[model samples]
Target: MKIAIVVKEHIETKGGLERYAVTLSRGLTARGHEVHVYANRWDVDESLIFHYVPCVKWLNLLKVITFPANARKHLAKSSFDLVYSLTPLYPVDIYRVGEGIHADVLRARFPNPLKRFLKRLTPKHRSILAIEKRLFTKGNYRAIITNSKLVKERLNQVYDVPFQDIEVIYNGYDDKLFNTNTRAYRGNLRDTYGIGDKEKVLLFASNDFKRKGLVYLLEAIAFLNRRDIRVRLMVVGKGKTAQYKRIAERLGILSQVIFAGAVTDIERY
Candidate 1:
């Protein structure tokens, strides 16, 4: 069957969504389906997008309607048997990807006017949220998949949707990359910072450290140190690095802590 997959960006998402899209796209290709992906050019792996469009950057916004417009045009011409949108973007046969965390945040934080403005400006995200909402009231999809049961459960709670319509697909790990072969992995990581083998290593990897709870992790480390657990925390990746570092210093764990900024091959760290 011919298919078209659409998404907002191609870059690896810190969350599970990136893995969701990549794995599904690859699987479909391997099965010999004609899959044409419409996505942002920033995403790696040249094979995924059969058609490239500017996505998520400032200049692309100048032609705000282009991505969806062209996506629709391509879908119309292709007469795809299935249009599985990785995001709740545009009108599609299916929206397999669920809503982002910002949904809960917006409901709590933004007033009506600001939220309405955001709705107008970036209808793609809001459209996904609306689709998710409709999933409760309508069961029209061939299938709707969620990356986590956590997300599926959220849908059930927020939308009063039954679990039957929402299928829970947990995130998968690339076992080859994460397997325990490399002491050189954590070893060089520890050695580079003079961390003793005896010292405990705590890894924190997040582009957005705050949401991933890095500060709280540091505090937990401090509490542990006060009680004499003797941990050597190793923070990896960017985003609020300075802030987390300051917290480490203030907590007097600076000497015990190492900030290894944004290692691309996280396995090495």
Candidate 2:
């Protein structure tokens, strides 16, 4: 079967979603499917075909609106058995909701009603919501794929999508690289960071620090410290460290937090 995978960017080493796109393309290709990826930008891979989806890179709103619009035009020129999209787009056979509902994210990020309202009024947010609404309500997809049950529930709550239409397929990892054998590096890693054997180390890894609740984690760590508990936070991701560093300093846990930015071998943590 010929398949088309749609995403904004397809860099394998970037975030989880990007990596998932790469892995899915490879897996499909390995199974004898003719896999083609449509993206604004992508790393070159010899195994699959690539189609450049032109996107306006100047503003967030333009970037959001143009990519899908242009992708649709490019995709229309080709015929494929399946169109699986990781991004929120229309006319897809399968839409994978890697990022949870945008409304739910706003609610979580900005709990105050006024703040949420203000955010919703922003051009990017408004565009995203509009696209998402059309996708879910108009049945743009034959089925929806979510990585978590939480996402599935939120999609149902926010968009009235039927529960049966959303399938929860959890993200997978390569067992050979991620299994217990990787624990052998634990001691060396701790030594490299000068973490004491008695100290408890909390690992937080994500490219999206704000959405992943790094601030909350730091606050929790500070609270632990106040109670005479010795804990170290090892943040391994590509997020900006300055703001989080200031936050840690304000919380008085600066010395306890270690920022190890963007590691490829995450299993070592």
Judged by whole-model lDDT over C-alpha atoms, candidate 2 comes out at 0.92
The candidate that achieves the highest TM-score relative to the unseen native structure: 2
Q: Model 1: residues >4 Å from true position, as ranges?
A: 12-16, 42-49, 59-74, 93-101, 105-141
lDDT of 2 by residue, 1-269 (tens): 99999999999878899989999999999999999999988999999999999999999999999999999999999999999999989989999999788998888778899999999999999999999999997558899999999999888888999998999999999787779998799889989999987788899999988888999999999998889887899999999799999999999999999999998788789
lDDT of 1 by residue, 167-186 (tens): 87666777777677756576
Model 2, residue pairs in steric clash: none
Task: Name the regions of candidate 2 deviating beyond 4 angstroms.
Answer: none
Error of 1 at 215 (Å): 2.3
Winning candidate number (lDDT): 2
lDDT against the true structure, per candidate, is 0.67, 0.92
The estimated TM-scores of all candidates read 0.75, 0.95
